[model samples]
Target: MKICVIGLGLLGGSFALGVRNTLDDVEIIGVDKNPEHSQKALELGIIDKIMTMEDAVPQATIAVIATPVNIIEYQLPFVLDLISPMGVVIDLGSTKGNICKAAEDHPKRARYVATHPIAGTENSGPESAFKGLFRNKTMIICDREKSDPIAYQFIKSIFKDLDMQVSYMDSVEHDKHIAYVSHLSHISSFALGATVLDMEKSEKSIFAMAGSGFSSTVRLAKSSPAMWAPIFEQNAENISEALGSYIEHLKSFKEIIDNKDMEKSTQVMNRVNDIRRVLKGIDIKS
Candidate 1:
């Protein structure tokens, strides 16, 4: 089987590594806009051969779009157009609604599957990829009925090989839920990182007193803006709602602490502690 992976960053390169490690007969072809990234992926053995988008799409039995959400929107229709009748085109865009809608009216829409694998690190690029990155992670397939039955089954089998647990959701619900869980968390991390850095520049020795707690909380801030900026734009409505709730909670907490009402603060924390139970069953990632 020939697989073409576009956008040779952490997600794309990691996917190539994961699938290659799992399947013996698979030939991996990489397509990237950056020559430097292609070279790096080659050095890391993430892809077997580097090819351009035009040269690779038709040759591929499967084409995986691992680009940023914005790129995926404009790129999906083109990929569907290039794929053979039996070929499957799967996307790994974080947001779902816009990407699914982008290819909704395409003649070859059935050739595409809109998917979001709920796994990633704050790192990116070919050098950052590793095998098993998606292992045991949740792979959400949106608008399942729109994809051809044979193509849908083919996608499920691939994710199963990678040890991903498959789940189905409507594209609209996927976007709304991810805003609170994934998007909001990233925004918080970025905001916190900026707050501390800005404070440090004003003469407070912040980093000197920082510890693992701070490190863990702010880790998502290191994620590439090239990738995240598009996600923020694409899912602004949902993300904005999530942010409003997060901000209201912050204000409530601040008011409690400012008034030195330790009893109410303790109650709030005790209630939030239930999240430990919710997260315990899963392999948690940022």
Candidate 2:
């Protein structure tokens, strides 16, 4: 089968690599707005060839939209218009509500599947791509009932080949859940990184004493702003709610510390440690 992958950045390049590694008889055609990214994907052997979106969609059995959420919202309908009736289009974007809603009323909506692979590092670009990036990760399919059964099954099989555990949810619910679980984490990391950097200007040798815990806490701050800024905008309501709740919790903890209520603070820590039980069910590495 021939697959056309749009936006040959980290997610797209890694997806191309994962598919190529798992499927022997597949041809991967890459499309990127950035010519440099397309050329780099070709040089890295992530795609069999680079083609314009206009040229690639017609030849592809499946077209994967791995672009930023905003671009996915803009380009998906155009892609659906170009692909054959039998062709399937899948989007691997982070935010789902806007992208899904964009194509909701299209006549060829049944040919499209909205998916979010719940995985990635705080990295971007084709050079960061690698095989098995989605292995053991959660792949969420939104509004699966709206997609044609055959198309849904085909894309599910492809994610299965990449070793992903697939799940289903409504598009709106998916966006709301991810705002807390995924988006809020990035915001926290970014805020923490910024706070530390501001402190470092006044306390010049601060980073020299930084340890692994600090590095881990701020890791997601390294994620691409070009990608994340759109996501934050698209899922603004839910993310804002999540941030408010997080801030309230932080204030509560601060209250406990300010009051010197060591026992209450310890109780709060012990209560949150219950998350370890939840994490044990997932394949989180130490």
Pairs of colliding residues, candidate 1? none
User: Which pairs of residues clash in candidate 2, taking residues 3 or more apart in a chain or in different chains?
Assistant: none
lDDT of 2 by residue, 40-147 (tens): 999999999989899999889999999999999999999999899899999999999999999999999999999999989999999999987898899999999999
Clashes of each: 0, 0
So what's the TM-score on candidate 1? 0.98
lDDT (Cα, 0-100) at 3 in candidate 2: 95
User: How does each model score on TM-score?
Assistant: 0.98, 0.98
The lDDT per prediction is 0.93, 0.94
TM-score of 2: 0.98
lDDT of model 1 at residue 142?
Answer: 97
RMSD values, in order shown: 1.3, 1.1
